[model samples]
Target: MKTVVAVYTGQGLADPLKKVFQELLPDVRLVNIIDDSLIGDVVKAGRIPPGVARRLVQYYRNGEELGADVILNTCSSVGEVADDAGKLIGIPIVKIDQAMAARAAASYERIAVLATLPSTLEPTMRLIEKEAAAAGRAVTLVNGLAAGAFEALNGGRPEEHDRLILETAERVAGEADAIVLAQGSMARMESKLAAATGKPVLSSPRLGVEQVREVLERLSREGEAAR
Candidate 1:
């Protein structure tokens, strides 16, 4: 089985993505590269400054020797740097938000982007809109940052996270055709968001696993065809 590597900035995403992928593509190896150091302070401070991207790029470089089949940056704060790393790595490097962005564009013209970190919202929205435009569609990106709720969850209070996410989704309900949760970590609250907004909820981790499955399937077919 081919292995795919995912790098999450300690947002506690590996398990979620791993679980989704295990069900979706059982044969592939899903490896996690966790770095709590880069995203912790920035998310704690409620800002995603420019330096964080460089740090992420450096981290990916150090792990380049692993020869991961696919490299996914699960931290939205470092997507630009993730793109840069993708350019240098010569592999199918995926931004965690990219798959969700593609799905959002395909599903709705007015997409509400929900994120746990304010720093992640803008980038995630931009990525979604960019994907939409590439598909010849115009998208309206709405910000639904639920940092307080996510912080509460990270602090061992899942109820608070659910409350805040539901509350925020209610506020943004009328404005979107579909709700797109920006982080793989944020997908944990999807059920609550869907119930509150009464709309379809798109999650990165779910789409990321879909992306992995498609790519791996293609690779597998190519190998079989060649033989």
Candidate 2:
């Protein structure tokens, strides 16, 4: 079985990503590297510190040593680090929100990036902008922060977390052609947000897993051709 190493900055998306992988690529082996403190450090620094980036690169190398066919970086806050790490890592490094950001950039002229943390928000918006620039598409991005939602979720008040996100989405929906949830942890809200806002709502986990599947398939095909 092809091995996928998922490096997470927090535990929020661990179960959800595993579930997505099970549904989308049942044959693949999924491994996780959770560092809950990473997100807190990033939030405190207001950006990814060099030491934090080095630590993440070390984790990616560890995944490589474990024989990962692909590495999934599951934090939008450190997504640019993932991009840089990809250059040094042997296997493909898939940023969890990359596919979602690409889709949003390509499909909508006005996109709103919704996130519970400022650290996640800026990187996600930058990613969408990067995607649009790469595709030569003109896009406008709006940022929406569901303030206190992360704390609520961490406090075990999921209902409050959802409520705050829903409110933020509703308020931003008027300005956006579609809304993109910046964190993989919010994947569960995709359908609900789409239904409530009557617009496309993109989330990372499923799309990221699908992208992993595609990469694995391509690698398999290349292996066969080499034979």
Candidate 3:
């Protein structure tokens, strides 16, 4: 069985992504390494400082140590450094947004990246720009921050959190070609966002799993060729 190492910088993603991997590619082995503080520290710092980025390199090295076929970084902020890790690890390092970003870039001329956190906004936009360039397309990014939504979730008001994002998504729907949710925690908004906006809503969970499957298949093909 091929092993996929999921490095999550936040909590609650493991269960959802596990279900995703199972539904998408059942035979592939999945391992999760969660560091909730990784997101918290980055959020507090307003960006990924050098120390935080260094820790992510260690995380990638740890995945390499585990003999992972591919490494999936589940947070967008730290996902900015995934390419740097890919250079060191020699394995496919997939940011959760990569597949989604590619799809959005290919299909949309104007992409609205909706986020509850400021720290998540810039990294996701940068990712989309890189993805658009790779696809030979151009995109205009609309920054939609659901103000107070993150605070509501942290304050133990998930319903309020959902409501805020739903409202924000509706208001911002007409300004872009499609809506892309930036965080795994916001995956729940996919259906709601699509329903309300009647626009394409791209989230990372399923697409990210599909990307892992594709990478594993390529690796398997390479191994067979080598043998």
TM-score of 3: 0.97
* Candidate with better lDDT, 2 vs 3: 2
Give me the runs in candidate 2 sitting further than 4 Å from their true place: none
Candidate 1 lDDT for residue 201: 93
How much lDDT does candidate 1 score? 0.78
lDDT of 2 by residue, 84-170 (tens): 998999999999889999999999999999999999999999999999999999999988999999889889999999999999999
lDDT of 2 at 115: 97
Model 1 TM-score?
0.88
Highest lDDT against the true fold, candidate:
2
lDDT of 1 by residue, 1-227 (tens): 67787887884787777788779878877777787877776776666656776777666765566766777778887787777677777667777778888888977978888777877888888888788888998888888887587679778998888778788888887998889887777777788778777899988776776777777778778889999
Candidate 2, 158: how far from true, in Å?
2.1
**Order the candidates by TM-score, highest first — what do you get?**
2, 3, 1
lDDT by residue for model 3 over 1-227, one digit each (tens)? 88899998888688988888889989978888888888888889998888888888898889889988899999887887887778888788988888988899999998889998899988889889998998888799998899999889989999999999998888888898899999877886798789899989999988888888888888889899999
lDDT score at residue 123, model 2, on the 0-100 scale: 91
Task: After superposing candidate 3 on the true structure, give the runs of residues whose Cα lies further than 4 Å from its correct spot.
Answer: none
Error of 2 at 127 (Å): 0.5
**Model 1, which residues run further than 4 Å from truth?**
44-51, 221-227
Model 3 lDDT at residue 44:
92
